[model samples]
Target: MLSVNSVLVPAEANVEVTFTSNMLVVYIDRHSKQVCLLPLDEKRQRKPKPYPFKVIAGLVEAEAVIKAQLDIPTYHLLEDSSFTTSRIVKRNERYQIISPIISEIHRYMFPRYGRSIVAQVAQKTGMQPTAIVRLMNMWFYGGQTINALLGDYSQVGITSPGKNARKVGAKRKNSPFVGRAITEQDIAKIRRFLNKYVLTRKIEEQMTLQGAYDEMLDLEYSTLLVAANGRKKVVAWSDDDIPSYSQFYYHARKYFDEQKKYPRQFQVTAAAYQKDHAGRTATIERINRPGELFQIDETPFDVVLVANRFSITGLCVGSPTLYLVYDVHSNLVVGIHLTLNPPSWEGMRQALLNAFLPKVSFVSGME
Candidate 1:
């Protein structure tokens, strides 16, 4: 880089920085004719190479002395008497006469004399382009662009264009279900099953690449829910059919436990084991209509969440006896409410009336 010692007008300063000997990416304010000195930072350069640099410096000094003999031959030609008969040296031939270019001279001088920029840099630098970038990025507006992307993701919530991508780094997170791949043998089996059942489930023509993936995730997560792999989140597969093994051992137990408690519906319960190929499982149970046979079940749940103590008249009860009226056929809960006191038989009749009477009145109002 060549420096100009002169200063410009009142508010302006011009600095000359030569990028290469020939090429430069110039920065200028044309109005003021001011050349801005861009901010440059040195990020912890590496330690010096002491031994080799010292040795090289010694070698170049030694070579310079011996090369003075070879240069003497060219000197006689310039001396003018007998040498003038041969040829005269011209300004243009000065460059052609010297074999080594300036860049090449720098390369040799650095290794030989410990003075070249590239040699000292290679000893103490990583990727040169990347280092140049890091220095430049700290200057004008690099961090702002990065912060904007992070801020945008926070504002619009995308996890690979999803929820909480910024906060939790969900793009880097492991998939909830990993082994969703359809293997060679598994694909053959799935293809066979697809022909038989895919259309029945309306998945034959409508399934997409991601739909295929989702189906696999559901089947896979269902099957390997238990067999714990060494990873805390990973579930191991001890059997040949990994999905079937995990499902039968882990999920089946839960299904059976659920069925035992609800004995009357056990035979007609939704089968979740469609992919496992063992017993009937309830995965895709088609829900019935909005309201049918009213279910009478009282569940104790916390009401403090929906209604604060001040709104509840400050009764100070932790749990409320919530009378939930659900339709047995449709599985739709018509009403869920908490009355102040413990419910009795008389309260039950009133609860039913309080739950259904509103609907009857609303329909009559519509009529």
Candidate 2:
């Protein structure tokens, strides 16, 4: 059977299309033998149209190669080994952001579901539908894998704030000072401020973007005024005297486009920072044998079971904790244990015993 991410190269020398088999089922009737093929191609539009699977099958039988069936090299294998740790981390982060969206729209990504599925998801998630669609398309075109999401960092060029006599960007509403133009000197000051306050390696010392902007204004543009009564006051600089916050932010992003860690304003928690930076120390080791490594975890199942199912007024029992042991090499579940009690040694022992023992038929009504 055709599976997800199966690349199909037609005999006619047309652009190759990847199959999204999850969406192949006919939505109108469940019993219908007629099914559609959700073929995605880079040159084709994002809209999913129903093409008869029989035609695709014929092409496959003739000469089309299901590339995924063969030992195709993955993104990690093809990626340059020269790439730095920071670049890899950034690519992973980008994938993390797009992963949730991909999962949300996986079944609806095909043409049979229509664009409304994307629109509905966008509305609920507060994301732009166009952006969501673009990401989806990128995933399909890039081999329907996380590696496809890695950005093209090959082109690195400095963007110069072109010399202008007057200020750039929209004027502030109801403000007399029509902002100062961003000069090379202003750009230099912005860089210094960003380095000192916003881009510090130490988390405790780092400042928010807005905080850094305020500090820049106070240090670089503020003036001390002395009145006739010998009273000294600090007068803030006008818009015309200093660069706007927008200008500062724009230059900061342009200059530090390849920043590994986000500033305080963008970071939600310390854990997020650790995930982006500190988490890279451990690399995934290649597993050669199924018995070489076994991973185990426990989670509360969604279902709740009662002490007695036959009684009308059965006490409400909480969800059972499910323990699973899986072979890391082949990703096959080796053992399982279900218990009403929370995670404990008993559950682990049972699961491990199940994994070590020979397989047997599980008959119903057996304790």
Candidate 3:
């Protein structure tokens, strides 16, 4: 399956390439079978061009290795730098501009990035051919994601304090209140609230980010008000006085990064880890023989059984527990034990005996 962002590297020393579209598969035709691809080269190319599907598929089947398959999450997760709102918006705008060009190219069976295609796309999108070509090249090389179009802000210098009086970044849109610069006091409060609420080894005690933010507001940014009716009420501070969720999230991410902890923790019990993770083998690749591994489990049967002699009286008996030992490699149930007794070592021992003993003698004794 060659899909968009699937990287193909040749066995020999050659420039690798990535598929830009799955048009050949979706719109397959006997007369024309080609896919759009871009070469992964240091020097930027003009645009993605079409390659014969038969030729590329043959190469992939024989000698080429699919190096990587990149999706939106994989691309963003692998990025070391964090994305700001402005950067995200800019990337989205660039994607919007190039999406039409991409769609136009995909419409044809075997489209070429020639002057004709470029001119058509330019006329339809009201953009210059050169600009479209540049963005297309950027999108292709950037793992075919909107985030790839984001500008590198790492080298950009921070704005001077003289630019704004109260706030450090852009002002809030469609709002009377403006966000203020984060102060040392605010950072201390954020740390305190996070420690008290967010980060915890106990899953049941963990609080969500929104809950932590709300707690901070109630404790730090709110004041008790006494009305004329003699009733006391808690009044939250103005938006300008309190930090926004984005600010809190940003600081929290920085704190986690400094502590070398993942933003989202996977909490698992010791028993669960031992069962699901510890000494686990890759069954698909490692298990090659029938007796190499056995999966054993005990489960109660769904239906209740009745005593054989008490059927006329309609006497009800409890459901029996069933223990099964499954052979993984051969996908067969090698051993089973059904008992009315509660699950115990006795049932397990009987099941193991049945598995090791000859089947003919066991069946003969049962009959």
Candidate 4:
């Protein structure tokens, strides 16, 4: 005996098969006119019954008519041999295992009859009910073929990881608010509003969080509220499409930390940034070599100088101006000029001359 577990057929097509005690079961496709012979089982056969010559002749004639319609040739039949018999036995064994499943499925489609069908199939076939259900579902969805029920394996024939993992809402799409209260779009709007109003605007006018919240609420309601005078009152703000301040602030803070915190802190607290953050004082300069530059300035000496020597007592004198030139790179005194007269442009000219003159020749004494 031979039976079919499942077979792939076209839509609205039927399968025809004729069988008896010891003959092979041949399947004919009603639409395609193709014939498939099922392997026979000697163990399942009763005491060797005589061949049904009439049935065989009718099948042969049907096959010939199908071939004539398709314009294909027919081949000669071979005598029975041990090899053919063994192949039949193996195929029959597999068929017997899968026959009951096919019968149950044919009796009740899986969608119409689910667990009950699986339970009945399990009871009749002695197979795991879930396995039967899974196979049936695969068959219904995957071309209704026995091959669709087979498991995938690696090249080495090992079952792949998670191949048969339980499917618990696995095909569902992810929600934007999976771990949060608000969606990403709402959070983005809050951040953009915060940046435009809170951080980037005038620092002096920036309000605290509570003040901002109150302002937002006022702005929200003000647009909808009409004045009693009804003088064509107009308000530019509306909260009709806006979210709550709490939700807005939560995501606003997140975007703020990522975009604004560090830069804003630097700008707000940069009073002594050059000396503190930059690690350099205002008076310091980086010089590499000596005698690169010079500095010149004039100032009155603290001590008074003698102006007249003709008097018995030295006349009290005013302080004389002293001009000094120093090298900025080496910190050395490059030139000096002294005179009793108050400072003038000529005094500066002489100071410049003194800087270029020989040190030994350019001598000066206090008067």
Best by lDDT: 3
Pairs clashing within candidate 4: none
Model 2 vs. true fold: TM: 0.29
Worst 10 residues of 3 by lDDT: 20-29
Per TM-score, the best of the predicted structures is 3
- Name the 10 consecutive residues with the lowest summed lDDT in model 1: 64-73
Ranking by TM-score: 3, 2, 4, 1
Q: TM-scores across all candidates? A: 0.17, 0.29, 0.32, 0.26
On the 0 to 100 scale, the lDDT of residue 299 in model 4 is: 93
Deviation from native of the Cα of residue 277 in model 3, angstroms:
75
Per-residue lDDT tens digits for candidate 1, residues 22-67, read 1111123234333322211323432111123233224234432111
**Model 3 over residues 1-367: C-alpha lDDT tens digits?**
6766776655554345343322122222335676566666435435556667787777677555444554334444445356667777888888887776567655532444367777777898798878877787766656555666874443255443221235645766788788676777787899888887767535567787888889999999899999999999999987877788888989988987787654334356789889988996676558877799988889977888888899999788888999999898998988989899888999999998888877887788888
**Candidate lDDT values, in order:** 0.36, 0.65, 0.70, 0.49
Per-residue CA lDDT of model 2 for 53-147, tens digit only, reads 56555556655544343232344346646567887786676566556656654345345454667767677667777766666665555556666
Between the candidate structures 1 and 4, which one is better when assessed by lDDT?
Answer: 4
RMSD of candidate 4 to true structure, Å: 29.2
lDDT of 1 at 67: 12
In angstroms, the error of model 1 at 69 is 99
